[model samples]
Every structure is written in structure tokens, then in C-alpha cells.
Target: MPLVRIDLNQGRTAAQLREIADAVQEVMLDVFAAPPGDRYQIVTEHPAGQVIAEGSGLGIERSDALVMIQVFHQGRSVEQKTRAYAGLSRILAERAGLAPGDLIVSMVENTKEDWSFAGGRAQFLTGEL
Candidate 1:
């Protein structure tokens, strides 16, 4: 399973937020091969002054529409990750009206042992996953 965190400026409506989250989960299912109902996502909104996202000289103009997505999951191939990047960008642009330049994504790799879905037990290790 992957834990996804979405951070954005505080302005979008609830529907837009849901669309963004759904778009991300869709990519996880398609590219990461994550099963249905494995979604664990959190969305946080901050004021414009609170979120200081810059392009790092990439020459991309980031605005209040900036969105930062962080995914924590098991290791994935480079190709899979690259596809996720592209898929997320395309989906967000088409579905949520987010520009590719306003989206930032990062992934962190962890082992199965790092997760405990419920009952204070490691589902993967216990073969319950």
C-alpha cells in the first residue's frame, strides 16, 4: 500500500480536491499496480504565504495553484515511477485543471515492515495482505 499526501494552496473547492485525490489514486492503480481500496491519502491546504514552492530554476512559474504530492510505498522500478509522473501530470491537467508546472511529486521507498494497516499488526508480514 502507498500513503499519499497532497499539499496545496487553500482555495480549491471540495470537489476539486476530491478530483485531485482520485486522479492520483487512479495513477497508483494503473502504474503502481496497487489494489483497489488500498488508498491512503491525506490532503492539506495552506495559505499562500505558508506554502512557498519555487521552481528551483526550472523556469516554471508556480502560483497559488501549486500542488505537492508525496508518496510513501515500497520500491518501484524507474519506469513505473516515470510513468506515474507523466500520468499524474496528464490526469491533473485534464481532470483538475492543474498545470504540469504547478505540480510537484516525490516518492519515498519503504519496506513492508514499515506498515501496519490495522490491529497493530504488520499485514504484509503476517500474510494478511
Candidate 2:
């Protein structure tokens, strides 16, 4: 289970946002192997200057289209993470017209105990997942 958070500069149309989010979901499914229909994402649009992402000496530049994606989920292997990153970069460019430099992705790993699907219960821990 991966809970994705997409933060982007406020300018894109609704269709653009949907395309970007769907592209990410595709990567999560194809690369991360998330279960079917387990899609969970939160997309937040911020005004200009709200999201400041600068290249850390990589000589890369970011524009208003910068999209920051954070995935919180159970531990995934390094290979999976690498594939996910590459897939996101490639697929977003193809499907959403997002520049590779304008994208930032990060992953946080946790145990099943960290999740609570609904009803105030830790579904994964209670065998409800």
C-alpha cells in the first residue's frame, strides 16, 4: 500500500492534474506492484513560491511545473524504487508533458503497523487487509 502525495505549482488544468496523478498510479502499479484498486493519492496545488525545489548542485533547473511526489508505504526493494523513479520520469513526460527535471520523488518505508485503512482499525495488523 502506497499513499502518494503530489504537490505541484498552481497553474495546471484539472485534466493536467488528472493525467499526472494517473501516470503516477500507473508507475506505482507497474513498478511498485501495489495491489489492484489500492490507489490512494492526495494532490495539492500551491501558489507560486509555495513550492521551492532547487537542484542540489546537479545543474538542473525547475520551473512552475515542478511536481513533488512522496510515497509512503511498506518497505520496497531498491530495485523496485529505482524502476519506479525511472518509470515516473518517463511516463510523466510521455503522458503529462512533465519535464524530467521538474519532477521530484521520495519514498518513506514503514511497517504494516503504521497503516489504518478505515474504521479506526489497523487493517493490516488485524488481518483485514
All candidates: TM-score: 0.96, 0.95
Q: Which residue pairs in candidate 2 have backbone atoms (N, alpha carbon, C) closer than 3 angstroms, thus clashing?
A: none
Residue-wise C-alpha lDDT for candidate 1, range 1-129, written one tens digit per residue: 799999999999999999999999999999999988899999999987887788798898987899999999996889999999999999999998888789999999999899998889999999988
Candidate lDDT scores, in order, read 0.92, 0.92
Over 4 Å off in model 1, which ranges? none
Quick one: best TM-score, which candidate?
1
For model 2 the TM-score comes to 0.95
Off by over 4 Å in 2: none
User: How many clashes in each candidate?
Assistant: 0, 0
Candidate 2 structure quality by residue, lDDT tens digits, 12-104: 899999999999999999999987888999999998899998999999889888999999989789999999999999999999888879999
Error of 2 at 64 (Å): 0.9
